[model samples]
Target: MLPSKTSVTDRSWRAGTAPGALPLLGHVPALWRRPLEFLASLPAHGDLVEVRLGPARAYLAAHPELVRHVLLNPRLFDKGGVFDKARQLLGNSLSVSRGEEHRFQRRLIQPAFHPTRIAAYTTAVAADTRTVTDAWRAGETRDIGDAMHSLLMRVAARTLFSTGLDEATVEEARQCLRTVSHGIYKRTVAPLGIMEKLPTPANRAYDHANARLRQIVADMIAVRRRSDEDHGDLLSTLLRAEHPETGQKLDDGQLLDQVVTFLVAGSETTASTLAFVFHLMGRLPEVEKRVHAEVDAALGGRTPVHEDLPALPYIRNVITETLRLYPPSWMAMRVAAEDVELGGRKVPAGTMILYSPYALHHNPDLFPDPEIFDADRWAGERAAQVPRGALLPFGAGSHKCIGDVLALTETALIVATVAARWRLRPEPGSALRPEPKATLEPGPLPMVLERR
Candidate 1:
């Protein structure tokens, strides 16, 4: 049996099942190799399509309504066993915590991402961005994706622990995060496979990456703990942050998890989106021109600050549209705690559910010519018409990404800063594709840097 719904349960068999599944692996190959096409194909199968991960049956909530349902009803579709791989690295951080625990942690960490904090963090954002892109030479090729990742890593380090975020720490964090991002998705799809236990090269690297990532966070916490002087950064906020009712502060382990949560959650999605923004601008010169004009008008030869964000509407729209086209956090998982009905069909208890912002954003009915990179779709009037859960670049509802504002602020500032300096032209003879790693990353984006 393929575990393709036909062999699992009658409810799964009755639902439209995604085809081309293997006996044991089921949809893992499809998901691993051609994730975008695989996800996009599910809507055609049915609004709620059944697929498999290893031997376990799962449902793909292809419609935004079902996705909204899953996202909103946290208790019903919580981050339980469905996200074991992610949980391994995330470690019950706010990103993965459920119930009252999640709420309590969110209360502690929310202040660090407050609008005021976001504005304060822009200095680090602008500086770190320039540091990464400054070394670019005219007519030279560079992996913008790698650069953005490194940039975001540095930005996070500076913002998280301004006191001791040296080059070594930033470099280690960047490398370890990339390793985890590269390996996490693979582990998720092959949950039941014995490859996880074997001492294979991939397994070794994955294990090493996980340990290194935890250590990276631990080192950051140690550095921050040693510095009694207030650094006025995210680490300081988190250190002092107390619960509203109980007035409780996070313990050492809790604080460590929170730090890892920010680094893991904030870095890749924002970085990849920024990288894609540059790549898209490369492909769409007209869009690039408007961004340039906007950046020029707002930040004439000066670095973009927090206040400059309001003046850079087109830049923001470009980022938003890029997000719509390639939301890095494309697929999100939820496991049904109890039996539930979804899309007028029965979804059995403990059934793992998946939703993709990539699929929904590409739904033509929602946004016509969904594949095209049209920033105007999110422009003033048109932006209003988008459904509430339709644009889930950072997800929606209670478990929505808390760093959404911070990430958006970083994107807008980086867009303004980079657009002001150079035009990144796509490399010749390169086959561009989104690799579904930690996020839907445009892997190895070799772009030609042209000085403005």
Candidate 2:
């Protein structure tokens, strides 16, 4: 029988096991020290494992169905505390809003992320990807992570912002974003508002970087606002977009926040996906060969147009498999607005629930041999074997990633383009590990690029 509320002490959670607690500190250090292993070790206790982070009580829901229920029923469980922190960066953007407000923002931003709009950027994506791939020397070794970061930021500048920004400006923006996002994640785990208020090196660096990023967005918006013509970029679209109901538009502050949101979201997640896909392709020869074969057959020696994506089944599978293993947003947090029952446990109002895509994606039952990195697992015939809501790289329900289709299209095109020109060989002695901060960063992916 499940333990009752009365039976379990308020100080400690009863549903799942803990690694025992430190006198007053709880599991903060342990969680920070080994987040991945700590989570991966949770199934021994129960599907809904409990962990203490300082004074706050957070539960990790490892069951795919429970995760689905919580995410799908956003009305019951809203994006809370951590999401509030996200608002510190994203402001009143679509990611931080809830209920009617969320619906409205989503509706307003929906058009920019539509498949048709994203497809229009394929030529730009291909052109930019080719530019990067062509620059890679055949025998020289390069850091794949850095290469993708540069390439992806360029793609984001052109496609998302429509800024036509140069490499130096994009690099500056990327550095600022890296600092701000890293600070945000650090603050999230260990609350640091007071430190931020005081002018320490870490705090000052974060503040300065954040300010610069905001200013860049402001300048971009100002230039667009001054322009007499529409450029069909996201910044222009957002600047001119009218809310259907009130016909009111986003103000300067809100506009800047949305721009930051797009830059942070569109750039980092896609770059991480590409990194993981490339890393996996280097590790798995059969997978890369199959992907190359599929891409070649689909394109038939012709360059891939936006329309060819629908027929590229294997490319989609490769992306899906990579996402399964290395989800960019490894974990997500939400707080219950009211009392709710999830996975037969009565969760109280305001209870913090953590849903980890990393954990769910690695569940052995949901994914047989989950760590194997097999693309065929996501193929049409086999994908149905996995339960609905099991694969949550883009999240689920209303709050699912708005850029899911765009991410797929960009990744497929870039991966295929690179494969068409170069083959990446992982360095024999190099060690690559998922260093997740904001987005998963597998830093210094030293690999040799051989021209195909």
Clashes of each: 0, 0
Off by over 4 Å in 2: 1-15, 18-26, 300-302
Per-residue lDDT of candidate 2, residues 1-452 (tens digit) = 33343323232323674677576677777777877767666755677887788787778877766677678779888898777766765677877888898888887878777777777755678778888777778899988887888898888788756645767888898899878878877776555556667778988998899999888778887777777677766666777777878887888888888878777777778888898888888888998898778777887665666777777888888889889888888888888899886655788999989888888888887888888888889777788788776789899878999888888888888887777777899999887788767776787789998877
Per-prediction CA RMSD (Å): 5.3, 4.5
Q: Across residues 1-452, which tens digit of lDDT does each residue of candidate 1 receive?
A: 12222222233322588999999999989987888888977877787898988898899988666677678779888887646566765677887778998888888778778999867766777877788778778999989888788788888788777657679877977888777766766676664756778998888987897788888778777777786766688888888889888999987898887787777778888888888998889988899899999888888899888988889988888888999999988887888889987766777898889999888888886788888888998877888888656788888878888888988888888888888999888888865788876678888779988999
- Give me the overall lDDT of model 2: 0.79
Task: Report lDDT per candidate.
Answer: 0.81, 0.79
lDDT of 2 at 56: 73
Candidate 2 residue pairs in clash (backbone atoms < 3 Å): none
- Quick one: best TM-score, which candidate? 2
